[model samples]
Target: MPGHGSNTESMETASAIVSLITASVAIWKTIDAAICSIKNAPARIQHWRAINRLLQTSLSRMEETMKRRKGAGLSISERKHYESIREHLQCFKDDLEDLQHKIASVALPRRFGKRTIPRQVLTALEIKLQEDPHLEKRVDRNIQLFQLSVALLSLLDPAPRTSVRPILTELHALHLQVSDDDDKLRKWKESAHDIAKDAAMREIGFTSSATDRVRVGRQPSINIQPTPQRDFGIDENFNKEELLHKIKVTQDLATRLEEAGMPTIASNFQLDAIKCGEQLREMHDHPLDMAEYVSLEERYILILISCQSYEEASFQIALNRLNDLASKVDDTSRNELFRERQTIGTLYAKLQDINSAIHFLRIALFDGYLKQQDLLAYDAEIRQTSRLLYEVYECSGMWPDLEVTKKRVRDEFGEDPVASSVEISKALGWCEKKGFTVSERDRQLYFNPLTNENGRTSLHEAALDPKMDMDVLRYLMLPEYYSLRDDSGDTALLLAADRSNYNVVEMLLTIPYLVHVRDRIRRQTPLHRCKDKRTLDLLIEAATRRNSIPPGTDWEPVDINSADCSQRTALHLACQQGRVDLVETLVAHNANVNATCLTGETPLVLACWAADTAKPALEAIVRELVSHGATWEQKFPVRRDPRKRLKARGFSNSDISELTRQPGSSTESSEVEKDASILMHLDS
Candidate 1:
């Protein structure tokens, strides 16, 4: 009877094993089919890998469980428990397969009318898939499977399943989600119980009182204070006084922080100051007395100026508010309005809004409240405003406006104004004639503003000249003067790069400050203006020399990756101008190969854009950038169209396929061939 029973048990075990293997194979085939369906999608690749890892783990566990149970002659209860665990595993497999199908469906492209689903839909799907909601469900299923295995093992064996304990512990640790309120309650209870115990011990031998019974069963009492109310108008009056005081304190603090080079912290304080100023205005029902109005304008102007560095948008908004306030002022306060308009014009000029700059400057110049007697007293204002007007007029080639501005200058100041002021004479190049002593000429030009209409200081004129005066450059090469910009906002270094003055550029290299100074027009560093390889080499060498500080020093290195207003780095400019040597030089100096411009053009994209015209040189540049790890990811917006941006400043429908074409493939070459054909047509 015992031999017969053993044979039956062996036969039953083999049959069960065969059934489990058949089910396992079916589950795997389902998973594989699901994976194959989604394999075409780049976004679904990670999900497939995750699912693979999960199934791989489940297969390993199932195989191990079967191996352990193979020779073991399980009783009826143990066999039933084993079957239950196997059934749970089968359920987990089905759910996992279902999840794979759901994910695969997400990867399948959707068609709406003639056009496919928009990229935004694909992006949303990618994000949704990446979040892996199904993975959490898989983990939960894992926990259930682990629990079932544990329960089955406990029924079959007397010892704990030590192998899975670590996994279970890890899962528990990962999934533990305690609330902040729960944590606080736990801490409070411990503290309260300790205090109650201490009180009971202290009163052990004393007579028990109603309040001294420890009160361990009752909740701790907390007293809440009632806030006293004041009259609305009086409260507002108090707040108005307090708000002004707060604004002053906050402004001072922000200034101190900014001076300490903590601009981010200073911005926080500035926001608070502006908030207080707004509240003060609100307290008076938004209608200010003349004195309060003037004070508020002054406060907002200071806020606008102080916040200009890091909060430019806020500063622009503040300028708008100040302009609105100025319009409300009567003619008696017209002088204040004029000053406000002048401030706005100056800010607009600094921000490179030339049209607005011209508009407000003209208003500040021609329409102030100064009477004929007081006009001479405001002579400095008239000259300064007229000078700015003349500069802009010259830059924009407004010849009629230039003549009008020249007349305005002579009418406002005196005729021969350049000769009357020694500083102005030197700034206008009047002192550059053969007779003046070098020291005297330098001194005269020292305090002159580079934007002065009178021909700017000889430094700017010499810097732009192809055959530059080396002696004059060395004489005026003081560090303080190196960053001075002309009317067009081109510094001496920028002028050299603009005109490709290699010799003048070499002279300016000794002063490190000149190399990093950005011109106000485009906020471009000198390196940004380099259109040739030789000039770029000179600038790079200068930058390296400047940055080669000894270890442990407090000097900041030159930012080779520093971007202009358009966010084009030095590398972007070098590649755009088709200087391969400069591109390689910039890359060697650690310029980001993947640095993008405002229009999402990488050095590679820019290089590729010109592949039709300058194929060999640009192809070499493209190859160099790729080897340096340049990617095709567009980091900035070019347009609403999904097509890649071209160098021609226009989009072509065929360019999209060309951009997305596989690099080094015949398709890529064909696109370039087509591009060449298109170019020929356009040129003709």
Candidate 2:
């Protein structure tokens, strides 16, 4: 008792597993002792017995799993969890044992070979428990912890071997019933008409009617009321989460049973859950708001999906009912019908029923409007709907439809990336949460190479966005994606560097040797394409940390001075067109500034050609490269003076024959040396 709840942190997982089982057996024996000691055990006695047995059985199921999991080796967090459970169970064992000892001390007259505890002893104990609110709360908390521990038995196992869910539901109902029984017993004990009033007959071994007495001959029965089924009914303003949670709970059971190879038994449970949703639907006969209507219908739709993978009958029934309900409301309730279309269409899309998705989305967007031709008439929701539908189209390779959605939002809705980012928030998750469960098949869409123009994964595209967190990226990674190039000849990292997206460059560099992954045409490494010094440093640092390339990958780790096919390194790209800060950072990191490209141009030659064309920062960039030990002197350097032996034509540009990509490749205006350059001319 002195160390009632102490030293749990010192306990190990194996010790916890042993101690928990010991404490569980102790608690069971204590409950049984308490049950045996009652002279005229109340109706609540059987409830306590049920709960005690349930806990014992639940603990037994957990024991094997806990041992197996422990054998598999516990993580630090797992060890701590079991230790805490051990400490709690030990404390619960102490509490129940204390109560049992108190009951045991109450010596009463012997009856049927057992010493009974008087009703007054239990009454006093109950009163003591009542005086301390925390004690009762402690018991409930222990039960909940036990519930959670049993729940853990199913941790990675496909099915839970334990019936903890339905058992807990029954335990909860029984607890309330027992609590009410206690209140009744307490009330009666306070009255003059309790066991104390019937004490004279106790000498002759007469038992109280508080329990069902076994008679010598026939059982007495009058008309009996049949027990009622589980009440799944609702009152006004019912808890939506509670009612709807039935879908998850029942489906959970069915899934477990199926996992246990009892699919025939499992199949009925989803149908049972759908039937409950139908009951919930019936209860919502009164008028409802749009959010409520959407919420209920969404749950109902999920119920249909759960019942049968694509049970056409249920879908048609819900569709007809919704249409009938819409008709009853008005010829046109735009908000209602639009949301219904969005909800159902999203389900079809998520279900990968592309044709149905496109059809319903068209109805949601254009059907209600008289001017269906004009996208300007549609609202922001239509834009959201269009985006969702476009994903479906894109998934199915329906390029024309995807283009139409994109064009509609852009041309009519004024969906500029910069402007529309602020205007469009994500649609409420009525649909997002409803689809795409994780499986290898579902993951195939993500990890598989897309057959379309961008060729499938937009991960390359996502990497270019400054805001995207590429850390969760490994979940979407496949071996092919490691070197996968988009249609534009960019690996995800190449795109990051091209854009000078510093954060994305930093993230991509974390993949060993992936920092060196190059684009197809320029064969330019990320280091080659990058313009900023921070990106340069990131790539250089990443190069040193390379490991053995992942198995099955032909990717070779690159040197810090590695060049693209044109033989230009990151330093070469930096000197000519890069900012003064970019040149300074590359130099500080010990970049090889004297390195020449395939065109025989040094960093100093390019810098000189780029400098003092009365160019302000250009002269500074040229000076920075030379100052960083770039010997364009070939030990002596010259400026825009073309009279030098080397004509240095490409110096104004990146010396393209030995070129690493300069920052702007796509746009000619941004490309500094887009035109064919004249050889540096000598003048008299």
User: Candidate 1 regions off by >4 Å?
Assistant: 1-43, 46-241, 256-268, 278-323, 329-336, 351-356, 369-376, 412-421, 424-525, 528-684
Q: Write the per-residue lDDT of candidate 2 for residues 268-345, one digit (tens) a residue.
A: 565556555655656555323444455454544444443221122444554553444334333545434666667667
Q: Work out the TM-score per prediction.
A: 0.37, 0.29
Query: Residue 175: error of model 1 in Å?
Result: 31
Superposition error at 87 for model 1 (Å): 36
lDDT of each: 0.51, 0.49
The TM-score measured for candidate 1 stands at 0.37
Residue lDDT tens for model 1, 131-201: 66555444344433443343224223323222222222222222332222543223322332232222222
